[model samples]
Target: MKQGFRLIALLAAIALVAAACGDDTSDTTTAPSNTSTTADAGGTTTTTEEMMTGPTFDIGVTEEPCEGGSPDRGCILLGSVTDQTGTFAAASPGLLAGHELFWARVNASGGIGGLFDVDILDSAIVDNGFDNATHVEAYQGIRDDVLALAESLGTTQSLAALPDYIDDNMVAAPATWWSGWNYPESDAGLILEAGASYCVEAMNAVDFAVSNFPTGAATVGIVHFPGDFGEDYLAGVKLAAAANNLDVVYEQVTLPIALDPSQQGAIDAVLENYADVTFLVMGPNETATIVGTVAATWNASGTDPRPFIGAGPTWNSALLASPAGAAFEGGIYFNSAPWGPWATDTPGHAALRASAEAGGAPASNFVSAGWVEQYPLKATLEAAVAAGDITRAGVVAAANSLGEVDYEGMVETVADYSGNSIITSSVVSAVDAAAPDGLTLLAGPFTGPTAAAHDYTGPCTG
Candidate 1:
């Protein structure tokens, strides 16, 4: 619908070219046409005319250049629906900065297919506040203006918009790592997810704890919130526990709103079971409260502190300054991450750091995550361009056809979109005050036996 003005302008240009050719009175100097030929996904050769003119598009693309792009190039606009002022607000800024930085680099290097510059306008980025309804509302507002979503954060929040996304033929790079994103049956092949799922991460976490702390980790406890984020991880923890012959001594599911001033319920559960190791699948605040309280209680009782492994979202560098800082520093907390931290030695990490430095963005693992998640979308768009069709439906086709996305070693390359190809390895990190993100790599990008051997038929939640 937004293509009206551009279509009119294109018609006018065609009319002028035709009129000039018809005029025999004046000596007309014709400019040489720039043309190229390429092969499509099916190996059919297409010329520039066929590739450029045969393809049709409706919204979120324009013949006009982007604000900072060369006048000769067109623009492809994308949107982002994410938390800017909600439960995940602390990490959103860095995540957004990472998106901007990634696109900036892309535009600077000559954007997709060397034909269009990509832009995610600030006006098109709406704050979902980590709420499902808000996420849907934000998406509805920008559905007609963006060719695709560059970032859609949260598991349930993204799921809330799935039906509309399918109807609109919109593709998105999800910010959450829910296991459901791996299956086309669950995501309808619309979500371009990066890294390992939360479920697999939990499996690896349990495997890491049991293998590393053999003397102390014979039993495990799980503390989580109720929905996909928590329950997904719980499923994997249980699977790994059974695989390793470790008993699940405790399971506590509590809400963030309920645990606010005090995480007494979760802490009491931990104390009662006194499991050697606990897997946390809650927010950073909840993580800090439970770890801090449990550590203090254990010290008071003169009991040795037990190790706590947390899913990626449950650890933030800011927690290092909270009351739990000492407990984290005492080697009691570890993070199970989808990818390496900000300081990982990889080409992708280096590029992200350079972009962040140029933009003066703060160092955070969320920034690394945000940067990593864009790869799948970038690959899909490129694929669509090669297929001579960048329309919404074409983009969806490109996404489903992708074989593997190169993250430049930020994490293991996602082999494919199938559930069987789901990445199972995870990076485990330990609290370190001196590390760039206050966390240092302790073990992984490694796949433990449980995750490596487990059959992934569908989403853990299902």
Candidate 2:
């Protein structure tokens, strides 16, 4: 029996290795092109057209202060706001570490355009518990000074302050888990950068479970944290499941961050009522707790195959701290960014590990996001500045002008606005638990359709 089990394990490992090494194919996409034309005619004899490019300027990033460094040349800022004090604080340091490493690399390369420093601005406020008003204030504090907003961990805060930032022509690269912000692509041109939207992430999870579990995952269950973010995901799951003909036997919504007794009970009620493959959309800790409790209960009762599978923020390193985390063995999930301890091969991943070692900070999934986003931001800003415009209009114009800026050997795909640049979807790295850590690249980032205008494109409908 033991020998057979060992053989099974070895085969699984081989399959995982093959999956990871199988494909590094790029998703080919084209962004809409932006062109500015100047025309002149003399005596109706000859006509000539000229393209006037914008001014070149600095791109700011989160930075560390150094004495005796050149002043004007290295003073550019790389702004950051994270939930270091909030429920998601566990992942904040990793995000910051990745940002810092990317910043260091850029600065070592003589800074952007040889004039700007990636100045690091941190709004490490806790927001007194995800209050919307506090988010507005946090954003206000950093909005004016930074060249561009790099990574925001708080979704509520990002949504609240986004309008004002856009009004001021500030560009934002957010970790928004909601997909509703996208679609009809012309909307919210300020949201130049985004992690994989929840819609895609949820579907990735769905696809993984169905493919891997097969006969085991005939029915589905959903347990989501309550909020615009969770709700958006719920909708996506339904859409994807229905389209795929997957049956959903259970669905329940819980609180945004906490899983107190009552909240846990609410979750338990759903799991009890609808038994099947479960989808979790809560944080790491909560997911760990629920998985341990629910799995033990079912395992003890001899529920036969047990809950098939699911995905959520619950799969990060933080969850591994839980003894019950082992319960997630063989579980599947979807990841937007490609930087994690499981993945040390990518440039961004290596940079993150180096940063973590240098700073003595623990790396998490969020950190990988920070690393990848820097590449996009750096590439976009470089192209924008090179196009000659540093003003908001110029930056937007340059973004629109880009065909596809390649970064770290990958093309950063984005939506081509008339003058506004937006990133569409990209393939996400699919993750599972095993040797080499199961960070597999999945489908992506195909350039979806763009909207006529951005502001009127989101849930608020402008």
Candidate 3:
């Protein structure tokens, strides 16, 4: 009986080795010719693309069976549910490349702990198109195939898929910072954000703005979307504003995340209030549009300059190349939850940039975002494997067990996921002509009293 079992295991190992070794090793992806712009983000409100029934995009992974006791024999299949097309298509260059290099390194290292390779199955990289229905559908179709989702990009989309994740006995690495995701009671060990939730980022940013106000007390305005991503920021802004005695001059959630051709109403509101500072929480595309539009309005109005601040996911370094670059080049700043830009001197971030550039990917923040997702997964998976419970449920427990992930200095503060709550902080950076991605570091490892006050112990109804 023992000999029979050994024979079966050996054959399985051979098949695994063949599967692991059968693919071309080019790490670079041919970046799509076009990148996303402000128009694309604004157009999301008015997009005409019919939701495709099936996303055929895949990473095209092939593996070879391995010998008994070899590292390749243990397969840890991780999935990615991200925007490959639709509204956020332009941002995918860095997003996809980051995940690719993370796994590439894992494979090259003879798999994690020299016993298992994290397999990002090609067919499983489905494009969510930034749509809730599509995100859920893509996840449903692939739920049976992967042990867990390594990355699920979009706040509402990821939240929509939460029930499925729980029912399917898995968890995911969400590319968002909704406060609810930070709560143990709400997340139930499913959602894991890359940095401080919007609530924390807003509080810290607001505090910074208030501290730097040169004259009379500052007045603030917030132009945001309506979803948790947006509401989360509103909550934080309000918290900080109240705490610091700043006047909430104007605040509105008038912009639709979908194709809204113009946010003139929102822009006009900020200008009308003449708020000294304005906080934003929109995708990179819309962020650029709003920032440019408002700057133009302020510039044309001949009013005092109103500096703009944004949440991490709300803006990307990609916008500096757009006409909006002029606005950012001005006196504008943004808070990023993750570490420094690709060219940052930090060992983890710089190394990721080198790998991404070598793989033919753009040296941008999106690529680093991908690396951040893998950081916790790597930590959790390594712990799980060591604990001898590497199945779907095991991964979830292991993920929960993940106490801290440094991302090789990608983040100023070590991320803590064990409590199922956000660590509540961020680093600030600014747009500059000389920085790697038109951005220069400011300050970070920011913490706020308001952020600490609201840990989001329940599901975020917003």
Q: Pick the candidate with the highest lDDT.
A: 1
Q: Write the per-residue lDDT of candidate 3 for residues 1-462, one digit (tens) a residue.
A: 000000011111111122255675653332222222223432332222221111111111112332222433445677788887765676666777788798777667776555566767778889898889999999887887776777888888887888888887677888777777766667677776666667777888887777764643478898887788888888888888888888988887765435676777777787688787888877777788788887777689785676778777666766778888888888654645545655566878767867877787766677778877777778776776666456667667777777766667665445456864455666677777676666667776657566667646653345
> What is the overall TM-score of model 1 with all chains considered together?
0.88
Model 2 ranges off by over 4 Å: 1-72, 122-129, 181-187, 257-262, 305-312, 330-341, 354-361, 400-402, 407-462
Candidate closest to the true structure, highest TM-score: 1
What RMSD value applies to candidate 1? Answer: 7.5
Cα deviation of 330 in candidate 1 (Å)? 1.3
Any runs in candidate 3 off by more than 4 Å, and if so which? 1-73, 213-217, 256-258, 333-336, 412-416, 449-462
lDDT of each: 0.83, 0.53, 0.68
Clashes of each: 0, 29, 30
- TM-score per model over all chains: 0.88, 0.71, 0.80
Indicate the residue-level lDDT of 116 in model 2: 50
Off by over 4 Å in 1: 1-55, 257-259, 418-421
Better of 2 and 3 by TM-score: 3
In model 1, pairs of residues that clash are none
Candidate 1 per-residue C-alpha lDDT over 1-462 given as tens digits, one digit per residue, 9 for 90 to 100: 222111111111211122234545533222233444455566544332212142344577776799988786678899999888777877788788888888888888888878778998778999998889999999999999989998999999999999999999999998888998889999899998888999999989888988788556788999998789889999999999999899999899877743356878899999899898989988787888999999999999999888899999888899989988999999888999988888888899999999999989888988888888888898888888767677899889888888778889987876665334488888899988999898889887999999889888888895
